[model samples]
Target: MTDQAVADDGPGSTGGRLTTRETAERLGVKPETVYAYVSRGQLSSSRAPGGRGSTFDAAEVDALARRTGRREQPAPAGELTFRTGITLIGDDRYYFRGVDAVELAGRHTYEEVAEWLWTGELRPGVRFTAPHEALAAARRAVGALPSHCGSTDRLRVAVVAAAAADPLRFDLSREAVLGGARSLIPTMAAALPPAGGEAADSEDTSAGLARQLWPKLTARPADEASLAVLDTALALLIDHDLAASTLAARVAASARAHPYAVVSAGLGVLEGPLHGAASGPAHRMLTEVVERGGAAPVVADHLRAGRRVPGLGHRLYSGEDPRAAALFDLLAQVPQAAPALAAARDVVATTARHTPLHANVDLALAALSVATGMGAEAGETVFAISRTAGWIAHALEEYGERPLRMRPSGHYTGPRPPQPLPDATEAPSQ
Candidate 1:
C-alpha cells in the first residue's frame, strides 16, 4: 500500500508515517482493531523501511477515527446526526420502515407505498385526488409559465400557487398535513398541460398517479407494461435516506414551513444536475447510442471530452443500484423498451471493460424516457413528484421535534477577526 507522505511534528510520528501503536492510539482503539480495519479495507497500511512493521497514513487513520465517532477533532459543518424511522440503506439494499423497499415497490402501487411510508399503513386501492380550488390555482400558475418551461419549474410554480390558495395550508396537525399532501401531490400532477392537448381523463381520480402522469409526459398512448414500469419507478423513487433534496426539505420543515413550502424546498434542490436532473444527460446519451447503433463511440466521446459517462455508478452502492435493477426488470416487459434497454446494457458493458461500473437508476430512467418518447426532463419530473411524499414524511417527523433543530453551526476558516476593516476609499488589494 502506498500514499502521499504527510509529515507531522507530533509524538509517534516517523518518516511521515505513524507506527501501528500510534495509529491505534489516534483511533482510540487497540492495535489489533487497527489491523482489523486495515484487513477490512476500511484503512490501508504501508510497510516501514526494511519491512520492520506497518506504517499507516496519518490522514487515512484520522479519517477512520472521525467515522468511528472519536471527538478528538471537531465535526465538520456538513456532518449531521439525527434519528428517524423512515429509511435504512445498507448491504447493497435499502429498506423503508424496515420493509425491503424493492419488495414493497413490487407489491404496492405508488400511492399505497407512499401511504405506507407516511403512516405505516398499507391501504390497497388508495387514490390521491387534488382539491378543486388547489388544482385550479396550480393549473393557472403553471399555464402562465412559458410554453418551453421544464416540468420542475412548473411544479415549483404550482406548489407556490397551491400554498397560496389553501386557506388551511398552515395547519400542521397530522391529519391536516396528510390531507394537504394528498391534495397537493395530485394538484402538481394535474396542473401540467397534457402533451399534444391530450385531454385530462377521468383517470385523475379513477386511476393510479402514473396513469394521470403518462399523458403529460408523452403523446403516445399508455400501454399496460409501460404504465407498470412508470408506476414502479414512482414507487421505487419515493425516498432515499436524506438525499440532498430531502435534507433541504427537512431543513425547511425544521424551520416550521408548511408542507407545500417544504416540498418547494426539495424541488429547488432537485433541479441541480447532480440530483434529480442527472437523468437528462443519460437520456441524451442513450439517444445518441441508439442513433449510432453502438455505445463505444458515444462512451469514448464522453471520456475524450473529459466528462463522466452519465448513468453509471453511484456513491452509495458499490454494485448495481437496487432501484435500477427493479426498473430494468419491469422495462423488459415493455416490448418497445427493448432497443433502448439494449443500448443501456451496451453502455454499461462498454464502460466496464475499463473501470467496472454498474448501472444506476438514472440510466434505467433514461432508457424508459428514450424508449417511451418522453422529453429528457421526464425523469426529473417523476423524481420530484414521487419524492414529495418522502419530503412530507420527513416534514412530519421534523414537526414533532424541537423547532429549528436542523440548524448547523458554521466553522469559520477565513482570516483572523482582528484584521482591520477595508477602507472603501482605498483601492482593494490585488
Candidate 2:
C-alpha cells in the first residue's frame, strides 16, 4: 500500500494500498468485478506480507481507471466502441505500435526492438524508464553460467534466474513495461554466446558477436561467405506469424506477468525439442551420415527402424521451408560447403524419393551450419538466434495490458476422498 496511488477521477485519491473489498466499494463494483479487472489486466494488486487477499495501490488503479474511461458515471446501454491504438494485429501479422515487425527487424537493433515491443517506439516523446538495474541483474546471471554451457541452454537457465531477481518486476507501469522489455531481450541474447568462431577479442559489433557464437560448434573460423549466410539466417528466423511461442508470450502478458516472465514462458516453450531443437538433431544426423560415408542404406535403415529423420518435415511450411532454402542458398556459397553440399543434395534426393517427408528449415539450416563448419550440433543456437527476435515481438504484444500474470487451469486426476488409507494388514480384499 506504500506505493503511490492517485484516483484518476479528478485526482481525488492518491498513493496507498487499499484492500480489494475497500477498492471495490470505492469503485461501486462487486469484489468479483475487481477480480475480473485484475484478470483482464484492467487493475493490479500486490501481496500482503502476512495477510490473506491482495491490496491495491489506489493511485495506480485510479490512473488505470481514468485511462480506461471507467467511472462512477453511467454509460449508454448500447455497444460503445473502444479500440487500442497502442498495438495492433492485422489478420495473422503483428505490429507494435503500428510499425510492421518484419520491416523493423532489419532497421532495428535488439534494443530498439525491445523498446518498440514494450512501448511502441523509443522516441524521446515516450517517457519510460528502461530497467537498467533489472537488465544488469540479468547480465550477471548470464555471466555466471558455466562458460561451457551450450549457449541456448544457458540462456534458458539465465532467464529463469533473472525472473527471480526483480523486486518490482511485475509492475505494469508504462515505464516498467518498456524497461523490462528493453532489458530482457539483449540480456537474454547477450547471455547467449556470440556466434561461433567469433574472435574472443573482436569488437562487439553484431557480426563480430555472431562469430564468437559460430565456432562453439564449428571449431574453426566461419569465413566471410559463412558469415553472410549466418546473418541472413538470423534475419529470416527473426519473426513468424503468431507461433506457439508467440502465443505463450501473449498469454503470460495477458495475465500481467512481467516482460521477463512473458519472455521466459516463450523461451521455455520454444525449448521443447519438437519446436526448438529439431535443427540440433538434424545437423547431427546429417553430419554423422555424411561423415561415416553412408548413403541410401543408412537413411533407409533409419526409416525402417521407425525412427524419425528429425529435420525432414515441418508444420507450417507445406512443400518446403523457405527459410531452409534461403539458408542453404547462402550456405552453398561457402568454400568448404562444396563437397558437403553435393553430398547433402544427394542425400536429400535419395531420402525424399523414399518418403513423403522433405527437408525443413531445420534440415536446411543444420546442413548449412555444417557446411560453414558449424558443428553438427550448432543448429540449436542458430534456432535461438533467429527465434529471439520473435520472442521479443511476442513479449511486446503483451505489454499493452496492465501488469501481467498467468494462472492456467489444471486437470487434476489424483486420488480422491480425504479418508485415511487402511493399514496394510487391514486392507479390504474383494
Candidate 3:
C-alpha cells in the first residue's frame, strides 16, 4: 500500500487525508491495529477515488492517536445511562412530564394522561378514538387465540392486527405517530374478550377507557366508583423512566421500526417473569393470605421456604410505592373491595413490622384484581396495557435521536483465539 503525502497542517487539522501505513505510524501501531480502530468506530475510513485501499481523514487519525493508551473505567455491567423527558423516578415518587403521577392518577383519564405523556399537553377531553373497521379487525385477531389464552396474549394479537390494518403505520412523522398510537390503544382495549361474555356497548367508548376495559376484566357490572379506581390505576401505570420494556421499545424505534413492531418488542420483554409477570406471584401470595384468614402463617411459611414476599418491596423505592399507595387509597373507597382491602392491609402491616419492606405497585395490582374478582393474570394485562402508553412515548422520543445509538461496545473476556498453534516445523518439542 502506497503512503499518500498528507499536507503539512497543524495536528487535528481537517485539510488532508492519510493512508493506512501513515495513519498506523502516527498512531504508533501496525496497519492491522488501524483497521481494528475503524471497525470499532473510533476512526472513519473511505476508499480512494480509484480502486484502492482505505484512506482516513488526517484530523481523525491525529485525534485517535491522542486518545491512545488512555484508560477508562469500564462501566458497571448492564448499566446504561439514557436521557428521557417522559418520566422521572425520585424520592420514592414518579412524575410524568413534571406532574406527580400520584396526583395525576387521582384526576386524569387514561386518554388525557397518554396525550400528556406523548405531547406534553395536559388538555382535558383527549380521547383515543378509532374507526369501526380497526376495532372489528382487532377483535377478529384476538378472537382467533386459543380459549386458554390470557388477556395480554389477546392484546398482543390485537396489536398485530391493528398494525396490519393501518396503511399509514409506516409514517414516522410526529403527528402521524401520535395519531396512530391514539387510535391503536383504544382498538386494542376494545378488542379484548369481555368479562361478561358480551362486548360493552360501543357508546361506552365516550365514557373513558376504564369503562370500556371493565367488562373485559370482570363479569360483574362496575359502578362509577369502581370504574374510577381502575382509571386511576391505568393512569398511575402509564409511565416510569426507562423500564426494561421501555428500553426495548426505544431500541426498536431507534432503528426506525414501525410503532407496532416497537410495541411488540416491548411486550416480548415484559413477558419475562422478572418484569411484568411479577404480579402473578404477588397475586397468589395475597390470595393465600386471604384464604388463610391471617397474614402471619402465610408470611412465615413463605419466609421459611426461602421465598421472597413478592410485591412487598421495590428496588427503587425506600418506602411505599406512590403508585401503590394511590391505587390502594382509591380501592378503599369501593365498597365491594373491602375484603381484599383488609387482606392487603394485614399483609402490609405484617411485612412492615417484620421487615423494612413496604407495599409496591405489584401488590396494589394484585389487590385490585382480587377485589374485582378478576383472575390472577389480570394484573399483567393491566400492566401491559397501561405500559403501552409509556412505550409509545419512549418510541416517539427515540425516533428523534440518532438511529442505533444504543449499540454497546463489548469487552471480550472469553479465551483469546486459542493462541495460534505454533507452525508445525517451527514448533519445539513439548
Candidate 4:
C-alpha cells in the first residue's frame, strides 16, 4: 500500500498508522519487540508503498499497548521507597513532624495541626476562613452536583471550582500555597450540602474545623463529646507517611501542578476501594454486629466466605494502630456513644479470638460514623478532608525537590525478537 493508503487507514482515517519507532515507544519496548509482535501475528503491519520500512495500524498498536501495559512487572525492589519528613509510622505508632499524633489530637484543632505539618510550627489561633468569592464559587460548584452525591464528590467539584476562581492558585511559594490551603479546607467544608437540606448554622465561624464539618456530615445536633471525637479524628488523620493518595499528590506537585490540582489528584486516588473507601465496609460490618446482637456470627460469616475483614489490620502496624486505639479510647468516655463503643469492643474481642489481626484506623472511623449517626460514607469524607493537610504538605516537600523525579524506568520483558517478516511477494493478503 502507498503512503496515501496508509494515511487513509490511519486513526482519523479508516485505521491509524504508526512508524516502527513510534510503535515501540508506545509499547515501552525496544524496536526488536515490534518485529516480534509482527512475527507472532499479534500486530499487523503493511509495507510502506515506496519505502523499505513497515507501518502499523495505530488502533492495533494501541490495543496491544494496553495489554502489555497491564502485564508489565511491578517496579523493582527498593524502587518504590522514598524519603519524606512528613508522618512516620513504626512501632505501632504515628507521628506528624516528630510529634505524637495522638498527643496532638488530644489538644490541638485540625487547623493548628495542619499548620504544624505544613510549616513545622504549631501556630495557635490559625483560621481557615475562606474568602467570600471563593466560598461562593465553591458553593455554586457543589450545588451543581446531584443531591444524593457524597461529601467527597462535592469536595472534588468544589476544589476544581475554587482552583479556577483563584487568580493566585498557581503561586507555589510556601506562604502563598499555605494560604491557599488554609482557605481551601474551610471553603470545601462549608460548600458541602448541609445534611438533609437544612441550612447550616452559618452564625458560628468561631467553631472549630470539625464543628464546621459536622452539620454537613449529619443533621443531628452537635454534642460536645461527639464533636470532640470528630476533632480528634481530624487531627489524628492530618497526615500519614506517603499514603497512596499523598504520593499521587506529591507526584503531581513534583511537576509543578498548582495546589488545587495537587489536591484534586490526591482525592482521585483516595476514591479507590482499597484506600479511603475501606471504611464503608467496616461501617457495615459494625452495623451488622449491632443488629445481630453478637459479634461471633458476623465474624464467622466474614471468615467463612474467605473475605478479608475490613478495618481489622494494618500492614505497617504489628499491634493496634495507635490512631485507632486513641480514637477508641476517647469514644469510651462519651456516654452517648456507649452502644457503638460496646459493639466495637465486642467485634475486636471476637476477631482477636479467631485471628491475629487487630483493629485499624478504618474501624475507628467506622465506629465513629455509626456512633454519631453520620452518613454511611462519612468516614471517607472525613478522611478526604483531614488528609488534605498531609497532601499539601507532601506537595510542598515535593516542589522543593527536583521536578519529575518520580518517573520510573521500565524494564521490558516481552517475546524475544530478531525474527523476520515474510517477503513482500510471500506476504499474506490483507
Q: Highest TM-score, which number? A: 1
- Which regions of candidate 4 fall more than 4 Å away from where they truly are? 1-76, 201-203, 413-430
Candidate 2 or 3, higher lDDT? Answer: 3
Alpha-carbon local distance difference test for all models: 0.88, 0.59, 0.81, 0.83
Per-residue lDDT of 204-291 in model 1, one digit per residue for the tens?
4557899989988888989988999999999999999999999999999989999999999999999999999999999999999999
Arranged by lDDT with the best first, the candidates are 1, 4, 3, 2
Cα-based TM-score, every candidate: 0.80, 0.62, 0.78, 0.78
- lDDT per residue, candidate 3, 30-58, as tens digits? 77998899999999987754535667886
For residue 355, model 3's alpha carbon misses the true position, in angstroms, by 1.7
Model 2 misses residue 364 by how many Å? 2.0
List of clashing residue pairs for candidate 1: none
Q: How far is candidate 2 from the true structure (C-alpha RMSD, Å)?
A: 12.8
Q: What are the per-residue Cα lDDT tens digits for candidate 2 across 1-430?
A: 2112333212222235666766675465777888898999878877644445677886666666556544442426642222232334444334544566545544544344444554445543222132445446655776687667665667776666666766667787766655555445445545554454343664342433344345544556557777666656555566565666766777877776776677667777777778776777777777776777755766777789987766776665456565566566766667777665665666677777767766677877777866766665466666664566566565554454344333435778987879698777866878
The local lDDT score (0 to 100) that residue 9 gets in candidate 1 is 19
Off by over 4 Å in 1: 1-78, 198-203, 418-430
Give per-residue lDDT, candidate 4, residue 307.
87
Off by over 4 Å in 3: 1-78, 200-203, 413-415, 418-430
